[model samples]
Target: MLKEKVYAADGDVHPDQQRIYGRGTELMDAEELVSLHVHDGKCILDLYLRKSKEISVLVIGMHGTRHKVAVDIFSTIKQLKKHLYWENNFCLEGKVLMFNGIHLDDSATFSNYNIDDKSVLYALEIPENHMNIKIRISTRDITSVFLSKSETIKNLKLMIRQHTFIPVDQQELTLHDTVLEDNKTLFEYFQDQEDGQILTLSLIHHIRISLTVCINMFKSSDYVVQSVSLLGSDTIEMLTQIVYQRVFILPKQQQLKKNGQILEHSKTLSKSNLTNGDIIFVDILPLCKITINLGEGHKPITVEILPNDTISEVKDHIQKESGILMNNRCLLHEGAVLEDHKSVDDYDIKDGSILFLSQRPPELVTLTFQRTSGEVSELKFNPRDPVSVQSTIQNIIKGENESASKSHVYECKQF
Candidate 1:
């Protein structure tokens, strides 16, 4: 096999390793190892063992200088260091050397390199892999973290923990919906994206998400107002209970409603479309106060009533307080008689408005009395009159006659 080789400092060939070929002998140009392809199972040991004797590798240093060094695979790394040199003919002593992204050590050999096979990168790509990543803890907080793209996700988390003072186990790094795995390298996760672009990484903690919720009972009643803190995972029904527990006094079996509909207990707040800093309005029945003028001309009686109450209910309440029967009472507002079957809201009896209440006039019957002398007497009669009708008619007939001798008689007749 024709092995490729280059000089340590210059392109001079090693004396003992050279060969002179005669007729029909093949001579090939030397191949320089400039780049390396990293894979899941490939390692620096595999690359070194694939070549034998002498190998020339082109290394690009941090200062942008090309370095050609000859490595003798047959000798140890400590022994080959004497012949290695860089651009200014600088000796390789105390200089940090890296092959395939691994920092070289005198004690480490090709067979004993300590590194993850997936993290092994080309020598010149070391600088490009050092990325200045930004970690966003919140909208107001952003922390910068310097890490290598060849580093594993677990390693990155460790470095971030040092800068953020957060526990590594509690941290979760995510790009979009994709959660980064600890075994994967940063380069693999963001390989398709461009460099220098701000990569947005979501930093989620293990604790529950906190948010503020505004409870508005004005939809039900204007008196209740409350603010509460809730977890994002909490359900809408849970929030309803917490809010109503403080605002409105509910019965033992009563439950709060939302927008006139019962909230689903199993749906989370986020799932129910209730986001942070959201307002939850409590559904309540509207109430109004009505004042009734009882014709006694004294102070009018005011009573609390619902808009949905029937007109009969209002009259009943008025009757109970004023000793007037509901049927005997008629209520009128603004010259309009209120029907018993209609609701209070239908009559537009707004809050603080006055309604007139008066006893119905009794039906009157006319009485006519005729005397034997052909004289006639007429008198008006009330069905609920306290005196007897006969007495009332006799009295009226007596008044029509000036004297007892000329008394007139009246008889009642149907008209």
Candidate 2:
């Protein structure tokens, strides 16, 4: 009797060892033998038998999953040859059962085997198509009017033309490896039959160009432009340019003061240079307070502090106190979820700091009512019946009719 259990390398009485112990029985008589062993922390079975004089078969199966594999076998006289072939070809270093009749190859001295299981039998379940990328383009600020309908490549060229002094002749665009001619326009490149119709515009330049056009052009138009960001290199450059140009402005001279003295004068003084004579007379400006309207039905709360705290930290603190989580829940800061990694610290959060938090809109409910007039009958309603105010009014009207005038009604509610 063979016991079934998961086997490990720590050295235990397992089915694999049992198969090795029963090798003598296989040698005495060529017959199929089924033996189970736990290999590589999985339950597997080995089958050994002589299939033909030229080949012996060794089959292995994993528990639960129906994975069966076959290998070569060798005679006792050619054990050294078998050992050499097994070592160099099969690479079976573990306690695996080697079949006797399975040859390395048909009529060859070697055997071919794979360690695949039943899991490989299943076909991969993949989505047929991915969601199309939705991009919001602002054409209002663009001086280049053609961009409203321009695909990715045209937009990049337009952006490049707007920012850099680089001449169109000096610019070289490449799709994959083939370098596009300097004179070849982006639209022409896509129009050419040689160039693949599917052109990936680089997104790197997208934000930079968008931002540049946005800053330069005064008007704003909402455009659903296809961003070329999916196009690898060009998009990368655009992104890098945008990020590099994002400037962090420090407080202006008028806003920075310390201990009755302007910070500009203390720039040359060390911390230990404190003296009564160093105190300079200065004019004090009244604190400027501006109330931020938090929309139609929201109350604004103020926090008095230096503008050093990040928006994320403030949101976290607000969440901790109000039992409302940010991000997962809604916390409307300036009409949108804080852009990407942008923090509240970017904006000044002084004494009269105002922020808004909004809950998601409730789901809309739909109700439908169907009425039929008939003979005298008793009206009944389900406990879970969802009747609208209008339906209730109609029901009251129907109930007031005579006994001979009866009607049945059906209503449906959807959320």
Report RMSD (Å) for each prediction in the order shown: 29.5, 30.8
Backbone clashes in candidate 1 total 6
User: TM-score of the candidate numbered 1?
Assistant: 0.26
Instruction: Kindly list the per-residue Cα lDDT of model 1 for residues 104-166, writing each as its tens digit.
Output: 444333333322222221223324545546676544233444456788989878866644455
| lDDT against the true structure, each candidate | 0.55, 0.33
Give the local distance difference test score of model 1. 0.55
The alpha-carbon deviation from the true structure for residue 48 of candidate 2, after best TM-score superposition, in angstroms, is 86
Q: Which stretches of candidate 1 lie over 4 Å from their true place?
A: 1-216, 220-246, 249-282, 319-327, 361-415
* Candidate achieving the largest lDDT: 1
- Model 1 — which ten-residue stretch has the worst lDDT? 28-37
